[model samples]
Target: MFVLDLIPAPTLRDVADILFLTFVTYQLYVWFRETRALRVLIGLLVLGAIYSLAKMWGFFLTTRVFQILWQVLLILLLILFQSEIRQVLEKVSPLRFLRTRKRSFHGAFVKSLIRTVFELADEKTGALIVLVRNDNPDEFIHSGHTIMALPESSLIKTIFSRHTPAHDGAIILSQDYITQMGCVLPLSEKKGIPEQYGTRHRAAVGISEKTDAVCIVVSEERSEVSTVTAGEIKTWEEPEHLAKQLKDWLGITESPSVKPKEYLKLAFVKNWGAKLGALAMVSVAWLILASQQEVKIDMIAQVKHVNIPAELILGPHSAKSVSLTLSGSRNSIKALKAQGVGVYVDLERLSSGTHQILLSAKNIDLPLGISVNNVRPKSIRINLEPLKKKVR
Candidate 1:
């Protein structure tokens, strides 16, 4: 009989970990590549670098100013990237994730889709496809013709070929299917989109603002490809480069798996620089609650043993020592003092063996056993001189 391999594979685990990081790094990178906030993000990084240098060099005042600015910059980035982040989250939604890989990527059929993109780009074809995410874009889809899912290259080429019946309008890519063709997205009227950007870019930005879907544009005149998410679009991108970008945004990467470290990093903030506002909000909540509650009250006191002159039977036998501490309402605690607190046990009643005691303060009272359970006392020593037994 052959024995099974019992040894751990260190190399395999390391490979798995690295592969996880590669996927995460790529995913984080792609999500930020084309959005309008990329510049501001760079600026934030520079500020962070400066802040780090200031900290290292003991420039406390300069670092303090940077710290404040960094806080604001962080919030703006979140608002700026909200649309793109929404799109990526839609891809991660459980209902959409497992069901769409066959149609979206990994399937050999996607190769045909890539081929069609190349063909469109080579011929300087202009087109827009707005993918609907999570929340239904039924209103947007109603504006266009409905179609059953079709094979990649042929159908994509047919629509944008300049010869097809619906070439003028944009396609709507929904989970596992292109549910409609020629969908008309409301063009973003906001001034944020540059005037030089074409309708293709406009539609990409528009649909992204309205929904969490990513928009891909193949510019006919420029022969350039761009993607829009979260109300921001980047143009003049190469088709190959855009492919990697989408793959990363779509949760595909050079590595097929995820790692614990990457998952944790992604969990807090795929971009930590962008999450301080949320943290500040939490801090504000804590402050508000703290301001309303009791202050300066921390502990209560308890008795250990009792001493009496009447009982001659006093030896090591004594009730367990109880610790007294300051506690309760602010006024009560403020008035309390170690002198005001006193431990008392009825020695006449206590048997020769042991007895419980009471600890009382200006307004505080503790049950017989509570004090010892709570506080560890430094010392509670009671010496008793037995009451002179009247010589009878």
Candidate 2:
């Protein structure tokens, strides 16, 4: 039978547990996709596959080696992806709310940002603007003039003008305000960045890689606008497209009319490869984890004699224990072990004679989702004797 058929219907808690695991897995997949940790994750998965196959095929040496590695895998992951792990913890920190409150950038702010970028692009003036999200970029801002002024298109344009002192540096915008200007951001050390892209583009990507910030960069050489986030850059050819992207990232929602085909095309057809890959990975993982529901394990349970008749005595019992095989999910089996499972033979109403008691499925007490499949030495022979009167 299939695993799902063998398993009982899920409870509300079980559903919640599954949903929580799925959400965590999806988020981790997304996070790994943008970092150097992705390659490490792929390598680990490949090793895991090999290990599984080795164990299945009875490659004892390989299996033993992999088993040893599994013991330290958690520590190895922690040491290898320490930075990524720190970033995740920082993002989920409760103290973050106390440190800074995130204010949604209004439509006016998005429009201003878009206008400023296009105006700078037209003048062939290089500008880098970093929009701070949950993470604070204050530490990355060095040798910068702190203005903490409300953002305006004219002010932004003036700061990045060719003649201005702050023109060469980046601007930091936080909580819908320009927190700093003329800020020097870290240059990206990542390889494969195009040689043609100058310090401004590198700074944009660098700050984005370090924090959850949306960076907008304007190229002086090409008069082009681009967005850098999560170490990825996308250049925009048209001002309208840049503006739409800015609005989308800045939480400025615009309800535009869309046809059914257009909706389908955007949702499914675009980036179909990534969508399909994600679905396949999640489905495979779920199946492998859930298939343990049908797993069976054999255990020996000692038979306990309970509630003996006062006038009778158990002279001899043929079978003191029975071999039992149980089928259930891994978790259920673990719980059964923890709770101390056992088999019991009741002999309270038996008369003074030898009798054979047949064991069956009904004789065992198991937890929900667990079922008894087979019991060895199905019957136990017991000889009972009447108690003789004795002098006090």
Candidate 3:
């Protein structure tokens, strides 16, 4: 009960405000998850929490250090994550979802891709193939001659053969078309790569890490087929599993194994923890910044004379307006309407004479949780002249 008392009662506006904040926080979480800057964001959040705790518990020294550290950290983060920040901004564009790609990767094209990959692997010929997804990989790839031919097993095999001049570089498959061949791709610089993985495998991992493209690398020495996505590599020994993964990634329809309702339920349950975490973080931030903190604001309230006697026709007073001091939670203070607030003076009880009326909290109208702290010109003196009777 005490804890509930500490928090102001929830209103419809409060509910809507918090819900909007939660939605924004969750969307930000989703965007950051796709970028390499997520870890940096988490580190900053952790430091913020520490700073808040230090200030709350009177750890002045630690609080001061963090205040200075934040400035330096911000500069460093901007310098280090410039590209990642740009990528995140690009992801936030609403038009991106509306722009759809013309996909030609059907069952037939997938089958051709499978055949071409294994055939090259069986011949111990090194090959690299990039399958473009939603993200355009043109910025990361260069020096490729455009082909734009239909994806066929024989054609793909011929291009990757040791005899062809283009066999040394990679081929890019976009939608249903072989967009380019002999394309130079960036190589992964990440340490801990296996000694067996050659330049082809490194290039596959590199491109996949930078974009959403799937890279398939065929090892010439081992005659193995491996797929790289999001900087991770997996060797596919079975054709069925590889086909299933490719279909899932490329948005190909498959025979349904579960009901529609069950599929939706599984999708919701897939990342339940992350979704809950985003909501909880938003709630805590709202509580600290808006719900608990109290702020004071000064505003002017116009004086309004009500229920004046009919016999009293004239009035002269300096109490045309009064300055009011109000205090409440930050949100409540922000929502106050200056025009709606006024000091009402009751004149029905007084006779036609010079009289003074006291102004207090009772005379002013205010919203819930907001209280009038002080009022200037605490009392108003008015001179009411008696109405003169005119001869008829």
Highest TM-score, which number? Answer: 3
Best by lDDT: 3
C-alpha local distance difference test of each model: 0.59, 0.79, 0.80
Cα RMSDs, all models: 14.1, 9.4, 8.6
Model 1, which residues run further than 4 Å from truth?
1-106, 122-124, 131-136, 149-158, 161-165, 173-178, 186-195, 206-214, 229-237, 244-270, 294-392
Expressed as tens digits, the lDDT of each residue in 1-392 for candidate 3 is 54554555557886788777776666666655644567778888899989988876679999999999999998998899776676666667787778885453665688768877888889898889999988889998879889889878788888888899989899998877889999999887655678999899999987886788888999999999999987788999877788888887777865557989999898568678876777688778767666546778888888888887888864665357889899987656655652368788887877887877788899987878898889887887766778889989
Query: What TM-scores do the predictions have?
Result: 0.44, 0.58, 0.63
- Evaluation by lDDT, superior candidate among 2 and 3: 3
172-278 per-residue lDDT for model 1 (tens digits): 76654677887777676546566667776777776676576777788777776677887777764455666666666554565457899999978667756445443
Error of 1 at 187 (Å): 4.9
For residues 68-131, what per-residue lDDT tens digits would candidate 2 score against the true structure?
Answer: 9987998988997787788778756778767754445766677667877888898898899998
Better of 1 and 2 by TM-score: 2
Give the C-alpha miss distance for residue 105 in model 3, angstroms: 3.9
Q: Residue 323, candidate 2: how far off, in angstroms?
A: 9.8
**Over all chains combined, what TM-score does candidate 1 have?**
0.44
Q: What's the true lDDT of residue 344 in model 3?
A: 86
Q: What's the residue-level lDDT of 40 in candidate 1?
A: 55
